[model samples]
Target: MRESRAKSVWLQREPSPAAAARVFCVPHAGCGTGVFRNWPPEHGPVDFLPVELPGRLSRFGETMPATFEELAADMIAGLERYMDVPFAFFGHCWSALLAYEATARLQRAGGPAAARLFVSSQLAPQDGPVGRMLGMDEAELAGELEAMIRDQGGTPHPELVAVYLRVLRADVEMSRRYVVPDPLRLTCPITAIGWSEDSEVRPGQMSGWPACGDTSFEVFAGRHNRFVDAPRELLTTLCAGMAGRGPSRLPVTSR
Candidate 1:
């Protein structure tokens, strides 16, 4: 993979001539690809590509995507130029859903299909709208953020938290306005990973991933934002699952 920034996309790459696989990661809402900075380097032997959407980090001035379809389309168009290699996708939260749609679209367009899709810390695609947080005014949004921190168990550094809250507001607005244009289904075998304490996503919602495609679901023992809170364990489990077959743990059933 290579580093480039297009209309509304920011791309980062970890190149290796010996790399047998490439993983494209779509970050959670408000998060830049920076979140995966250490992933590629640490989990060697494969190339890692982190995708940056508009309105975050380097692409700060660009308009945030309003709907899921538009976001997926933008990603496909922006990154299709670099699709020569076999690849996979790892996405968190809303990005998981976005990645799923984009991959499905790519297959439909006769583009090369990815080897696997690792969706983490997100509700299943078939779950009813998971309720958006942007409808609240700034004050209400702050309160919601506090509640999220309490429920999710990880708070950014104090200074970082302040900046992230503003970014979070924009993310919420984008997520709130998002509408899916087609059936929320995928043909790829999607592995769904979520936090055990994530109240925002229920067991039923996680189990609904099968409705999206051939899926395997598992719950990590942590809060909603487990990716940030628990890095090594999460990444290792995620990469191992994607690189091989089956989840790190036994498949989960809906509660």
Candidate 2:
């Protein structure tokens, strides 16, 4: 495998070959590593590596995965090169399940194992998906898109929104048809983060995540998209968890 290929695919604000540990983050649907652009400043103990999925953002030239299997395969292939160091996984929304499955795939492939798993604003793999975006028409989706952009602190320009809509529609359709997995339990600890104000996903919905492993739940103050901008609180907890030492308590800002 070409080492440079993984470098281009994963976004690390501070490229640290000397870090003690690494945290590879998986973004939500239609999200890119751009969210972590301002995080983890240089010299952090753990390397903050945010993965950019194919078919979106900088990877627009690649075809998007049509199903969960394809997504997992793509992740396994692309990330196998980075597993030499002690690492953890963090993912949000629908992609959180993707991260879990990818971790399993890594172990199955005789690749590296994650030190920890952090899934936020999403249910466990057994619960399946819970959104109606798949059934919405383009017009309805456009309306939702505009509102979503506004909530994320951005004004959607027509052309840009159109492109975003395309990626979102594909992502939603993929999620809607997804089959929940009978996941493999990990030896590592799992952390489920609930967004206090995120009506889309409640803390109870993610309670099942503990079944995957030795899991803990923490709540942060924010809506569903709060982590998109890479909040300081979120980064701190992730860095600590991936550091692979000391107490593993997460700072909870909410229930």
Candidate 3:
């Protein structure tokens, strides 16, 4: 079942009597749980719960996060419950940085850390956000936003487009202002996913991930926003990590 409390949105739809591991999904900036709306609540034995950040969608009245670190900190308290059992995190694009920081914060607090960290359609946490979205003006950004919405097969009216733009601008600004801190080693594995046709982040740009943990790279078929649709390959990749305890018995982050 899905629950929207003060800090985060837990999008688990399963009412299974017995629970297994869970996968907490974090959306890219300006996006919401709507991205994973079509994904099943249970992928095999694991449950899927997508995290809805504050100030977006149902949390529209909340303040937008100032930094990746700050956002992660805000969500940690609410995320504590899922940690009672084995759980991991899945983040795409901007959420990759947020997830990494959140995982780190969890480790620093000596809390139940995530089983794994799956990052898709993005570069390493140290690589940061780089793209045409960085310098685009209002007109260019508007066009880009419309193109993205249309690519996802949605026809957006001008008024609705403006509403999205307001959030998009703030999200992009956060990305621009972000600076990846010195890398800290984490016990959990880090998987960086790339798309062969993705124009935003390429395979070569996905290096430097080992700074975070024992890292691996996987390539799937699609574009930058592919994860928004929750493709099969992406779900399968995530399900692989969700199945059981990885090489590390307990994941941690070291300063």
Candidate 4:
């Protein structure tokens, strides 16, 4: 019953039983697994499992997690069964911090530790609560949300935007309240990925990650949201990173 509940609430779909390894993808603030709908189900031996956090999409109306610690605990509980295999966590933007917190806690819990934690376009915890959205007021956040919808070629409905605005505000507040002066160094290595065109988080800002664990940094050529498309280059890097191979430093060509 616990496994059934975890599968229904946390994951978008059942994981690939035959895959050699899995990479659980956590979305950014105010979003759900739909951000990863376009991503391939599997990239060679690695299966991509997009996480579905509460207060969004199918989990809408559920209470949003009040803090990162709560959020991490919930994720760890929901993903316990799936952790039997070699696995990693991939989080983008705000969820990168979530992934880090969960990985740290999971390691200390005497469970299967994550093989790697892949944080994209986010600063290390000690260097944060830093991000443009952290300083934005509700009006500015609403505008930002609208702009994102427009960029995706969708018209933003006022009602939907209003709901997402509340979720966004809560997420932003959670981020603001998260102050990890001295974060726990994880047993797993970290792969910090920076996008060349990401105006929000420059690669230089991610320099503090090495303080957390054995870390490798890679810069891909694309804007902040490009990872949502699950580019081949990014998948290659993740595969190599999980396999304990050194950074490929793949030659950047136009996306």
**Tens-place lDDT digits, model 1, residues 50-104:** 8878776777777766677778888888777656665777887877877887887
> TM-score for model 3?
0.87
- lDDT (Cα, tens digit) per residue for candidate 4, span 11-124: 878888898889999989877788887789889888899998989999997998899999999988988788778899999999999999999888788878899999998989
Residue by residue across 1-255, what tens digits does model 2's lDDT show? 634543556554434678777777787776667666655543377777778887778887787878877888887776666677888778888788888877767767767778888899888887777766657898888888788667666787898778877887888888887766676777788888888888878766787776677777777789888887677778777776776532434344323
The window of 10 residues in a row where model 4 has the poorest summed lDDT is: 246-255
When summed lDDT is taken over every stretch of 10 residues in candidate 2, the lowest stretch is 245-254
Q: Return the candidate ranking by TM-score, descending.
A: 4, 3, 2, 1
Our tally of clashes for model 4 stands at 0
After superposing candidate 2 on the true structure, give the runs of residues whose Cα lies further than 4 Å from its correct spot.
1-7, 10-14, 41-43, 245-255
Per-residue error at 62 for model 2, in Å? Answer: 1.7
- Candidate 3: misplaced stretches above 4 Å? 1-17, 244-255
lDDT of 3 at 85: 73
RMSD of each: 4.3, 3.3, 5.2, 3.2
Clashes of each: 0, 0, 0, 0
Q: Give the Cα error of residue 226 in candidate 1, in Å.
A: 1.6
Residues 97-132 of candidate 3 have per-residue lDDT tens digits of 778888888888888878888877666666666767
Candidate 4, clashing residue pairs?
A: none
lDDT preference between candidates 1 and 4, better one? 4
Clashing residue pairs in candidate 2 are none
